[model samples]
Target: MEPMLPEESRFETGLVEVVGGYAELPSGWTVDTPDARDRFDVSRLTRLLRDHERHGRGWPGSGVDDVLVEVSDTGERMRANVVVRDGDEEIRAWGSVHDRAGGRMLFVHIVDRDLPDDVAKVCSDVLFHWAEGQAVAVGSARGLEVQQIDTGAFEDDARQHDWLEGAGFDRVRSWWQMKRPVTPDEATLVPSTDKWESEGVRVRLVGRGADGMPDHDDLRDVHDVLEQAFRDHFNSREETFDEFVHRLREDPGHRWDHWWLAELLDVPDAPQPVGALVATEVSSATGPNGSYVSYIGVLGDARGRGVAKSLLSTVIADAAGRGRDRVTLEVDADSPTGADGLYVGMGWETSYVTESWHRDVPVTGTPRQQG
Candidate 1:
């Protein structure tokens, strides 16, 4: 892959250079940073990686914009990427790190699976070590004593399981990647009033303001509803409103029309936001695109009032109205709320499985100096 000339990177150069693993690279191998022009090659690499992991699932994988978000530096959080190239200058391994939120860091470790075992092991070791250093830097910057390094792998990919285990990461959780098909007739699934109401719960799309942005109060309501809903869930973290909006907008599939909020009525007080469903478009290389529920949350106070179901039904109806094919979502297999059961009862079926592997690295000694 060709690096962009006069490159712009948000990566802390001083911190990266001082990281301990570069010397471990073989003499003929080198490390490089990718920029906008490299998105195609990087995206191709991503597609190949996914295909290999899924045993030739034939999925289209990520597009250029997905790679652009990771390789670009315009978002709220800081992220860095490194590609390992052989003497022929072809990329054999790629590692990207993101300071996702306070105390949590995300790592994407991809090494060419076609390489010999020894070569692959070496590349994996180097990338894992480098990720550890990056995690420390991120944690220290946040005045945190330790940072969680979160990464994922396909359930059947034993190679990834081995690499992550070798790097001290534990298989912490499993997720069900579920999908539900939509029919054209379902477009009328939502009432003509553009809302769904049942048992004192009402769901509707978040209203837009005169400026075309979502109403500020409504947006905050969505954020607050989700935060409180997931507060006790696994891996829960406190993300500020600014961070929440910035992260969601970074998605290439984000659409203002896909956002829906739920309210509880017939209560003693004024209507209150009890649930929210944030969805996105899932473009397919062939056939109609689908909708994906990025987040669907209902507050604890409204649990049994059918708020969650109403919000989900609204998205499915919205997707049908758009002539979409399906709706997809991920649910924790071991959720205390029995969310998987809810999805299964609502017509969703598990299409695949993925596992979360994590390692907590302690932030010790001095923080990386800024240049």
Candidate 2:
């Protein structure tokens, strides 16, 4: 991953100057680039925003590390972030944009909960306008005619829904945020051996090479399996192998040992991967830590053969072995595969719900693009 531009100019010029539709800041309010020194204030703002979202939901809020990753310039190369401060010099709003992949961008819009409705609305507009400009810049850089700005809101957050809709985004899909408890006894759920086998499917952690990096072939197999498996899923898009790897590594909880691959051994030829699961460690300040399943995909040909189940069981058992108290994951509420049902059957319960919103912004011959 590389910085979008040189260090000296990235913050001074900022994203708003890259395209049209710049939002005018109110009197005495200022928007500026965030750095590591702002982590305390920014994280406090994030916690405030998360607290507002948690009014009716029990979703675990983000940690300071999560907020730091977005604010720190050296943390994520493909991301740009800015904070809005009131006249009192308090950070009232924060906006972040991630060049997620070709033709798609991810936006995070947050405003202080205690602001007056009118002021908060204005802040929302400012963030959305900034996001649109960033999207255009990202699209032009990728040589794309249009870029889809994708964002999410808790299903019950009326304020967020209104803001997103007002910004030309449409409610696209719902997701079930699920969690399942892990018991120490479940550590025996998988075979004691490093590789667990059942009915011709074998599950094991991705191998590490002598250099301590993951085996390239194993990683490629995981990427291929996931890419093919999600092709027909909602809002699926083609992500290059490099982009996929880079994006996942940006997560604060990312760990190499949490990656797993499942292979079919019954075939006549050499065994090939048919399923993959990537997990991350979630920390907790009030209770025991947890494991989060970031990605789980089983090839279409191996779906009915229990590849999904095997991969999931491996994760649960691994979590238990690591003394994690629970495992969490999110599934599409309307998945064609009935993934929600499978998760429920495995003892996962919905803790909260979220919806995806999308707005496609067209990229034309802007001055930046022309140059």
Candidate that scores best on lDDT: 2
Expressed as tens digits, the lDDT of each residue in 15-127 for candidate 1 is 35535446656778877765556655666556645655555233535666777777776742467777777887777887788767778888988888788898888888877
Number of clashes in model 1? 0
**Candidate 1 to truth, TM:** 0.91
TM-score (all chains, Cα) for each model = 0.91, 0.91
Residue 241, model 1: lDDT of 79
Give the lDDT of residue 245 in candidate 2.
82
Clashing pairs in 2: none
How far residue 225's Cα lies from its native spot in candidate 2, in Å, is: 0.8
**279, model 1: CA deviation in Å?**
0.5
